[model samples]
Target chain A: MSDHAKVIKKHHDHHAHAIAKPGKRLMHHVPLAFVLKKVLGHGGRNVNTALNLTSYIDFLLVTVIFLLMSFSAGGEITVDKSITLPNAENVEDVIEAPMVAVNGQSVMVDGTPAGNTRAIRDAGKVQKVDELFELLKRKKELWSSFHPDKAFPGVAILQVDVDVEALVVKSVFQTAAFAGYPNISFMVRKRAKAGGGEGG
Target chain B: MGGVDVGGGGGGKRAVNAEINMIPFIDLLMVTIAFLLITAVWVTNSRMNANAQVPGPPNTEPTEVTTPEKILHLHIEEFEFKLVWQQGSTVVAEDKVPKQEQTDKEFVKFGDLAVKIAEQWQQHGGHQDPSDQKTDQCVVHADNKLPFRELVGVLDAIYDKKREQNQADGTIKNVPVFNMSFSIR
Candidate 1:
C-alpha cells in the first residue's frame, strides 16, 4: 500500500473507534464514580455529588413538614371519640363537651345513668341529686387545669328531654351555673334538613 | 477555542441538575399528606370516649332540713313531661307538659310549660331574698336524653323571678339559682 493511503486508513480506524464510545460513556462513569469516590480518594467529588443530594433532601423535608401541618389542621371533633352523632328530625347544630344524655326519665353522665331503676321510673328521688353536681364541679376543675394557659370558670354539658318544660330545663341550668360552671353548653341533634348530617 | 468549547459544554452542567425529581417528590408528599390526615383524624377521634363509665360523684349522706316544702318532681318522658309536686304520699300538683308544634317553630315545644310553672311559682310564695328564704332547694328530675341547652333555658325561666328581684335589689347581676338541684334517673 502507498504511505499516504496507509496513513489515511489508520486515521479512519481511529475516528471510527472514537465514534463508537463518545462522551456518554464518560458521563456514565463520572456519575457512578462520583457516588463511590470520597474526599480521600476523589478529592471533593462526593462534595459535588452532595449538592444534588441536598436538593432532593430539602424537597423531601419540606413535603414532610407540609403533610404534618395538614394532618394536625384536619383534626375532627367526635363524641366519646366513638359515636358519630345522629341527625335529628328537629334540633340545632351545637357541639358540646361532657354531653349530658337524658333518655326518658334517666339522667345520664357521659351516657351512663346516674340513678337507679326505681328512680328512673319515678324520677323524683332526691337521693342521688348531689352526685351529679359534685361530678360536674370536679370536671369543671379538670378542664380548666387541662388548659392552664387560659382561665375557664367551669364547663358543663346539659342534655334534656325534648318534651321537658322550659322551666324545668331552666332550673337545671340555674343549678349548674350556680354550681360555678357558668361556661355551659347544650348538646343538640342537628336538624336533618341540611346536608351537614352527623355522619363520618 | 478550547475555553469556548468548554463553555459550550458547560451549558449541560447547569446547577439545576441537582434539583430533585419533582414527580417522585410530589408522589411522596401526597402519600405523606394522606398519612398525616388519617393520623390527625384518628387522634381527634379518640378524644371523647362515649362509652366511658363516668359516674356522678358519690354522696356520703343526706342532711336534715328545717323546713321541707313540697318539691315539684318533673318526669321527662319520650313525648311529654309529667310534673308532680309531692311530699310523702300527698301529691300537691301533677301536670303533664304537652308536645307543641316543632316543625317550623323556632322556640321549643314545652316552652309554655316553663311559663306556666313560673306563674304557679309566683302564686306560691316565690320570694327571692338573698338574706333569708323558705325551702332548702327545688330538685329537678331530669331525663337523660334532654338537650342541655333546653335544661338551661328551663332554669333561666324558673329563676327569672329571682333574677328580676335581684336586679331590683342591686345585687351583682346574673346570679344563678342556688336553691336548685337535679335528680337524673
Candidate 2:
C-alpha cells in the first residue's frame, strides 16, 4: 500500500475504535493521572452525585393520599376558646345551627357576647336570660324573613363549659326555647376510647 | 429516566433529542392533589347531631290515663348519681353511685348499677310497648353544684350497660339506652 493510503487507513481505524468504545474515548479526553488521583482520594468507591426527584415526589404523593383518606367528613362548629367541652363516651357531632357558648364568666351567642354568666346566674332563679333571648329572637326573625314560607327550625347549639353551674345551663336552654329555638343541643368532645369515661 | 440517541451522520455524532411530556400529567396530578387537600380539610371538621326538648306550656285540661308506662329518672348530685326506676307513680328500683365508688378500681360497681337498672327495666316490661320499641327516653335531673363531667360519666355508664345487654341478646337494631332530657330539680 502507498504511504498516503496507509496513513488514511490508520486514521480511519482510530476514529472507528473511538466511536465503538465511548468509555475509552471519554477516558482519553480526561487525564489518566487526574482520574487515578480521584479514585485514590475516594478509596475507589462510587459516590451518590445526583438527586432522585421522582422518588421524592412519589413519597410526597403517598403522604398526601394518606392524609386525605384519614380525614372524617362531618358538620363543623367553631368552638370558642373560653369553653372547654365536657368529654363523653357516646357524644355525637354538633349540627349546623346558631351556637350559644357559656364560659366561666360570659355567654356568647353566635360569636357575639350576650351577657356575663355570673350576672345571669345572679338574676334569681330565672329560667332565661333577657339578653340571650333578644339575640336569639333577632336570629329567629332574620331566619323567618329569609325563609318566609318555612317555620323556624328552632335548632340551637349550646357549647357550655364543663365546670359551669347546671342552673346557668338550664337558664340558657329555657331562654333559647322561649326565643323560638326550642330544640337545644349540648356540644361535647368525643372521648378517644369507647366505653371509657374520663373526668372533666 | 432520560436518554439521547445518536443518529447517522458524516463522521460526527448527531443526538436524537427526546423529552418526557410531563406538563399534562403534572397538571392533572397537581389539580387532584389540591382538590384532595381541600376535601380533607372539610372532612376533618365534621359534626354530629344531638337533640333536646324543652318543657311545654302548662295545660289546663286533665287527660285520661291508659296503661301506666315505666319512667327512668337519673339525678346527678354534687358527688353522686341517683338512678330511680318508676312505674307510673310507684318506685321500682333505686340506686345511688357515690364519687368515691367511681374510681378506676371501683368503676365496675358503677357499671353494675347500670346493669341492675337495665334488668329492673326489663323486668318491668319497659321494652315491650309498641310505642317504646325504639325509644329509650330518660329524665336527667342535674344539681346546679354538679360538674358536667360526672353527669357524662353517669350517662356513659347507663349507655354502656344497655349496649352490652343488647349485644348479648343479639338484637338487630341497637339503640341508645338513655335518650336524655336535662332538668334542674
Best by TM-score: 2
Off by over 4 Å in 1: A1-200, B1-65, B78-80, B101-109, B125-127, B130-138, B142-162, B165-182
Write model 2 residue lDDT over A39-140, tens digit each, in one string. Answer: 446446567654444765676578667866766565245788877676545455556789888998998998898878898667646466889999999999
Most lDDT-accurate candidate = 2
lDDT (10s digit) by residue, model 1, range A16-36: 555564332333344465544
lDDT digits (tens) for residues B1-185 of candidate 1: 00112223355565432333556655676687667656764322111101111234587899576554666665656666676767655877777776442433323334455555655554443344554434323555556545544454444334333332244456643332224455533
C-alpha lDDT of residue B72 in model 2: 79
Relative to the unseen true structure, what is the C-alpha lDDT of residue B75 in candidate 2, on a scale of 0 to 100?
73
